[model samples]
Target: MDDSALLQFSRQILLPEFGIAGQTRLSDGCVVIVGLGGLGSAAAMYLAAAGVGKLILLDDDVVDLSNLQRQIAHDVNHIGILKVFSARDRLLALNPSCEVVAQPVRFVAHQADAWLAEADLVLDCCDNFATRFALNQVCCSAQIPLVSGAALGWSGQVCVFLYQSGQACYRCLFADHPESAATCSEHGIMSPLVGVIGSLQALEALKVLAQVGDTLHSRLLLFDGLHQTWRTVQVSADPACPVCSAADSP
Candidate 1:
């Protein structure tokens, strides 16, 4: 790295766990973030600022007034812009050296493999069950690590699936699609709650990318903001998990 980059990431590089070697690993990592909402906003900013070399941001939605409450990346000034592009601008503004590729298209099963093939790590920052399930399958198939996070009302959760390590996939935990997943518009979320969870996603992503520190790896972290507590539990692989039972892992 050049003196300029060393100075740019001096604070993080100074850490014993992260020194120049970790920074080099981070500089060579490619991350895919599937949403630009509250969680993605925080994750994207931190990942870019942390020096993830390449970021692929995907979102088919546009910014709205309601999102400003927690979606920090998109400001009032960015209203009506496609989320991926808006987030790309914000991430670039934070770290111009980071390559932010904006994919303003909804990710579906058909595009999963092609899009996720080169990802070193994937962040499931999108809302909705279908997308989450699809990502789990694709990441598991590609043998990539996934950093997943969710926030609703006064609660949030974050987890990492080391698919390459035979860890549990998301479907192992959620076998059946829920009849309904609550939305922030209907349930109301604390602004900082998503930040907390999203920051954890960023932390886990960096840890995985740099191969430093411990990661969630088959563990689920539940955060109860109403009570200000966090608990982690083991997530065992389901022998009958249709998605991962006879998985195609790379």
Candidate 2:
């Protein structure tokens, strides 16, 4: 690492476990953000600020006037613009050295393999359940870690799926809730609620990337902003889960 780079992340390098090596790992990692909404905005900003080398920002929606209320990365000037571009600009302003790739395509299966194939970590910040399940399948197939977060109406949840040998995956936790999933647009979300959950998602992603500290693998974290309380529940893998169970079908 050059003096300039060292000077940039000196605080992170000062840690006992995260010396120059951990900083190097972060600088060499690539992560994909699957949405540019409230959760994605906060998560992407923190990820870039923490020195992830490359960020793949995937979102097909355009910034709307209403997004300014909660999507901190997008401003009034960005209204009608593609979200990925606006988020990329904000992230670059935080750390110019990080590479940001903006993809303005709807997240779909046909394009999933190419985009997620080389990612070290993937963050599922999308609002709907279908997108979450699709991203889970992709990450499970690629054996990449996924940091998932969601918030709607003063409530939020964050969890990590390691795709490790014996850990439970995302599909295992919510196999039956796909039909009842709610969107921030329809249900109304508290602006800062997403920031809180998304920030935790970013922190989990950083830990997974740097290989430092324990992650929320196989455990679901719930944040109730209305009541100002938190809860954690352990999750177990389903032997019949179509995604993770496929690994043993051979």
Candidate 3:
């Protein structure tokens, strides 16, 4: 590492667990984040500041006045601009050395193979189940690590799934998508609630990148902001789960 690089992340490097080696690992890792909204905003910011070498941001939406309340990565000047473009700009401003690849299109099932194949880790900060399921399927097929999170109202949940570990995936926990899944827009959300969950998501991603510590894999973390409590539920692989079944079949 160069003098400037070491000086930039001196605090992180001072830690025994994350000494120069761990910092170097992070500088060589590539993480793909599939959203630029509430959760994505926080995750991307932290990953960039922590010196993740490469980041691929995928989002199809445009910045709006409403997003400013929770989406910290964007500003008033970014209104009407593609989220991926705006987020990449913000991330570069934080760490110019980090490489940012902006994909300004919706991630669909058909394109999953290509994206998941390229990423070292996948962070699912998306809101809808369709997108989540599609990404999960791709990760399972590619045998990649996935850090997933969701938030609505004052509640949030986060989990990690590694296909190679023979652990349960998001599908195994919630077999079917809810017919009436509430969104932050309709039901409203506490801004800081997203920050809490997003920070947890970043922590999980860092663990995956560093290949250290016990992660949320095989378990689900549920956070209730109103009650200020956290609960962990064991997750087991389901033989009937289509994604896991396919992963284990061959």
Among these predictions, the greatest lDDT belongs to 1
Comparing 2 and 3 by lDDT, which wins?
2
Tens-digit lDDT track of model 1 for 63-144 = 9999999999999989999999889999999999999999999989788777787799999998888899999988887788
146 Cα displacement, candidate 3 (Å): 0.5
For candidate 1, the 10 contiguous residues with the lowest summed lDDT are 241-250
Clashing pairs in 3: none
Clashing pairs in 1: none
Give the better candidate number (1 or 2) by TM-score. Answer: 1
Candidate 1 vs. true structure, TM-score? 0.97
> What's the lDDT of the predicted structure labeled candidate 1?
0.91
lDDT of 2 by residue, 1-250 (tens): 8898898889888998889888899999999999999999999999998889999999999999988888999998899999999999999999999999999987896788889876999999998888888888888888889999989999999999998776888888888755677677788988898899989999999999999998999899999999999999999899999899896457
What are the TM-scores, per candidate, against the unseen true structure?
0.97, 0.96, 0.97
lDDT of 3 by residue, 89-197 (tens): 9999999999999989888979877666668899999989888988888888788899999998899999999986568987888898887777888999888887888
C-alpha RMSD in Å of predicted model 3 compared with the true structure = 1.1
